[model samples]
Target: MGSNIVFSANNNEEVMVLPVVPEIEVNKPQNNEQFETLNNGTINLIGDEGLRTFSIASIFPSQKYSWLKHGSVAEPFKYVDFFNKWRAKKVPLRVVTSRPDGREWFNMPCVIDSFTFKQLRNGDIEYTLDMAEYRFIGGV
Candidate 1:
């Protein structure tokens, strides 16, 4: 399947200037399981039910755009503000990934665990977001 992915704010109307992240990486959710070893050398399953979690990483590249009217480099700053708002409010994010086989996976109810920003020598800004899925929203 194709590896193209897209990320969008769940509450887009509330956020007028969302960060433009061109490249994204999504790790599928996994089940949480526990096991206990019995005295008789038997393994007992314990508490296999809980929330499934996943992670997503995206990169924001630096470039000149005419949309800003003037050659502007404010994209990174805008992203910083965007991420900070989401982090402070503790909101859920939605992610959609497309496979090469014409299938798509929709992962939702994701909470931001961490946000990272890096500045390169060429003035390119890279942002990576680590997130965890709080609940399974199912995939199509």
Candidate 2:
């Protein structure tokens, strides 16, 4: 019911809202196994669902434009630092995404797999973040 994509590292209370709604890429692949049979045939078995990956590529504009959505957008480095700190802590973040009409779309615990950014010539920070779903195995 908030921004399109929001990151909450502390407990879903303090959230770092995005400045611009970037492209949220989701990848969920199925885990299947194949074995060779005795008659030169193959047997395929379907496994459980694989963890979904969430990717967001956007730019932090130095100055807020008229079309920007997010309300509270801080400095470019602030966002970079936010993810860096959470990543170093090795904690699972609650990633939430909603539709335009305020409907819950995808919500889950995800870990930051990789984050890359570059400073553009116009003082904007272009970044790409990759995160994977985190499942509690063997009872956390």
Cα displacement (Å) at residue 73, model 2: 0.8
The runs of at least 3 residues in candidate 1 whose Cα sits more than 4 Å from the true structure, single-residue gaps closed, are: 14-40, 46-50, 56-58, 64-74, 136-140
Q: Candidate 1 lDDT, tens digit per residue, 1-140?
A: 24444445655543422224244444543444555566655554544455545544444445665433222234566666666786687666665555546477554556778888888776656666676666635652
Each prediction's total of clashing residue pairs, residues at least 3 apart in sequence or on different chains, is 4, 0
After TM-score superposition, the amount by which residue 10's alpha carbon in candidate 2 deviates from its true location, in angstroms, is 2.0
Tens digit per residue, CA lDDT, model 2, 1-140: 34477789868655777888876769999999999999979998999899999789998777777756665474788888888888898878888888888897898999988999999998889998989999978986
lDDT, candidate 1, at 87: 67
RMSD of each: 6.4, 2.2
| TM-scores vs. true structure, each candidate | 0.59, 0.87
Q: Where does candidate 2 clash, by residue pair?
A: none
Best by TM-score: 2
